[model samples]
Target chain A: MLGTTFKRIIRAGVVGFFRNAFVSLATMLVMMITLFVIGSLLFMNAALESTLDQVKDKVDINAYFLTTASEEQVLEVKTAVEHLPEVMAVQYISREEALVIFKERHKDDQLTLQALEELDENPLGASLAIRAKDPSQYEIVADFLEGQMAVAEGEQQIIEKVNYHQNKVVIDRLSGLTASIETAGLAFTIFLTVASVMIIFNTIRLAIYTNRDEIEVMQLVGASNWFVRGPYIVEGVLYGFVAGLFTLFLFYPLSIYMSSATESFFGSFNSLVFYTSNFGMLFKYIVGSGVVLGAVSSFLAVRRYLGV
Target chain B: MSDSLIRFDKVSKFYNGGPAALDAVDLDVKHGEFVSIVGHSGAGKSTLLKMILAELYPSEGAVLIDMDDTQHLSKGEVTQLRRKIGTVFQNFRLIDSKTVYENIAFALEVAGMGDEEIEVDVPHVLGLVDLHDKAEHFPKELSGGEQQRVAIARAIVIQPSLLIADEPTGNLDPINTYEVVQILKKINDLGTTVVLTTHNKGVVDSVGGRVVTMDAGKIVRDDSGGQYML
Candidate 1:
């Protein structure tokens, strides 16, 4: 009997799906588009973060010490600033060494050599070149130095302006854009989920409407409401499952292809791997979500319109 | 010897505070008898039939099918009770989506009959309706009379103890109507109680069975060998 019921549900679902072919196709197209948009947005956000991290790896801030500062005081400040947890690295450059390095790098540049020869003495200060764990945290380190005891007093006085300003606005905009993308993606996902369900519900409701006469007949004949409704409910679930499978077939390949593109372009980014290599896992998630959406919407519509 | 298979004792049915659809109606249908309910439209024939099926609960008093008060039965049990009685509608109500074979087979399927039994029984019922050759045809492809027969096939397929047909031949011509009434009589002779509600006065006279007449939600007459008197 269970097997028979299964066959009947499958037969009915197939016929029902094909009976409303245009509408069913429209529903599938809408669902696929929604899933693709949301999926791509998530992938893009991840890629954006990965690319920003790569660029941030190249920039760092330098802190110079006063000639009057004791070596012990500079060492203490270095230790304290390093202990603040945001500092990635601090390389101390002495005044003579800083000047020698600058001259060596600029030796072939006639304009810079001429400028340096005009100076009687090297004006470059002894500095600590500091790399931060995140460029966004550079302000935090700078604030610690100016407000807290993280930097020694004489060294703090000798320190020139922090150079995180150029990247700060760009970093802030990226952060805001990431957040907005995530928020819009979340809202769009929810809206699309609801819309997909409503479409399925309306579709099933049409199927039910076409059979209202038969249902009324069944009811009159003392066929229990279950006897009347069981087949259609089974039919609804079948629609859900087929839609889910179709959704998986479409999105999983798209995910794989997009991930391949990301791999070629970005060179082994974690976001690409996280999004693409987990295609099967995400497909299962989507299929589960689609099935649940289809079934629940169908159930609600059946209960309300069919009233079975 | 009319041993009542169904009894309605002072049954009153009202709809949402309006006037009663069936008011203080007292009636009975005996076992192995073919009873036809005839009156003008709005004479409460359908409402009275619906009460027997427990589709509508009586606002007051009791409805008894085989001495069991249907008023107290839960909805689930009402369904079980309904399985014991078969109903046919004026529209034939054959499931158009199904073939003639499936239309007959569905009743037994819902009743949990084994597939082998359904396969055996569906053909037998279709043969009884004389539509075995058209078993693969959908309801829309059949004539009005054929569709009504399919409806009968589905109802009688379960062999219910009571068959309630509301306007079974409402859309049929005189010949087709006669055919359907003959089928109902034949099923009645097989010991199933038949409760038929119709507006066809000619059918009531020709069937020569008990006639229950109603007017404004009240039974005006119920007599053996009765005619279609209002």
Candidate 2:
């Protein structure tokens, strides 16, 4: 008995979908547009997060030691900074290693290489590169380095200078900008989601309203509320399913095209890989949200007319 | 009342403190009886039928159908009650989108009948209504009498115990009206209790069964074998 009822419900749903093809098509199109906007925002936010992470990785404070400072002293300072809870990583570079790295970096520049080769002995000082857990912690790490030099009052100062002075303003601005952008992105996504839900609700309500006569006839013929309601709910689910498929169709190719365009404009950052790697999870999210939106809207819309 | 298929005891229906649509009245319809309710436009004939079908609740009394109080049935139970009592409106109310065959089959489908049973039963009802040739035709393609026949076919396809026709031939000509009255008489003879509400004197006089005449929501006359007398 249940199976027969299910078959009839499916048949009725299909008939209803086709019987009101224009309204059904309008509903699907609106759903697709909403999903597309949501998908694009999600993808953009994910890409922005990754790019910010890369930028944060490059932010660090460099402390240069005096030429007279012993290698052991520099190493000791590196180890102390590394042990700090706020420090992410600390590396000590000797005077000789710095010169070698300088030469390698400027290998293609003849003027810089000539200037480096003309020096009789290495004038570069040993330095400690300190990275903090967050850009905001860089100031504390720099202060600690300066305090170490101050403690060496009677003897020569172990640390000459910290690069935090040069980079502090830029770092502070970048962190603040990223933080606000993230908060704004989250707020915009939420607003869009709520608007999408309301639009879907109104659309479904209108569709049901157009079919009010049919519903009245069904009730008069002694159709159970569920028997009349089941088919419309099924129709709603189908709208969601089809909208989801269309979103996927439009999203993948658009992501690929945008990825390539961004890579060319921004120099070799392949943003497309993020989409490809997470395609399965994203697909599930879009389809699941569509189904939920469709089902919920239709249920509410049909309930108002089922008072009989 | 114990043997009655439908009983309305002291029934009254008021709308927003205005005059009653159905005044305090007591009536009984026994099993397998053909009862025609005749009245003018606002005599509450339709409201009485609505009460029996559980579409409207009496304001001051109880309506019982098959010994079950309609006012107390759950939503599901109300549907079950309506399934046993098929209703036909003056407008025919055939689903315009459906063919004659599909229109009748829909009633069986609503009753949860299987496709094979519907396939067999729909054709039989269509043949009974003499619309076998118009099986695949939509309601708009049929004449007024033919459309009423389709509505009748839909009502009886599920084999309801009670058939209520509210001016079934309201839109039909004299010939069509006569044909529809004959169909109702034939259906009543087949052991289904029929309640018909109409203002047409010719329709009431032709049935010649038990007639209940009403005026201003009150039944003024009731006869075992009566004609249409206002």
**Per-prediction tally of clashes:** 0, 0
Error of 1 at B130 (Å): 0.8
Candidate 2 lDDT, tens digit per residue, A1-308? 88988888888888878877888899999999888877777777776776777788888889999888889989989988888899998888999999899989988999988987898978789999888888888888988888887964577777888889899998899789878978998999899989888887888889888777767888889888878888888889888888988997787777678888866754435557767887887788777778888888888888889877
Residue pairs with backbone overlap in model 1: none
Q: Give i-RMS (Å) per prediction.
A: 2.7, 1.3
Computed on C-alphas against the true complex, the DockQ of each candidate is 0.54, 0.67
Can you write out model 1's per-residue Cα lDDT over B1-230, one digit (the tens) per residue?
14788888899888899988888988877788899888889878888888887777789989888888987888777777877887788988877777888878778876767889998999998888898999999888999999999989899999999998999999999999999998998898898999999888888988899998888988888889998886
TM-score of each: 0.81, 0.90
Predicted structure with the largest TM-score when compared to the true one: 2
List where candidate 1 sits over 4 angstroms from the true fold.
Answer: A1-139, A147-177, A221-230, A237-278, B1-3
Off by over 4 Å in 2: A66-94, A105-121, A130-134, A137-159, A266-275, B96-99, B137-141
- The CAPRI class of candidate 1 is medium
Q: What local lDDT score does residue A266 receive in model 2, on the 0 to 100 scale? A: 43
Candidate number with greatest lDDT: 2
Model 1 lDDT, residue B170, Cα: 93
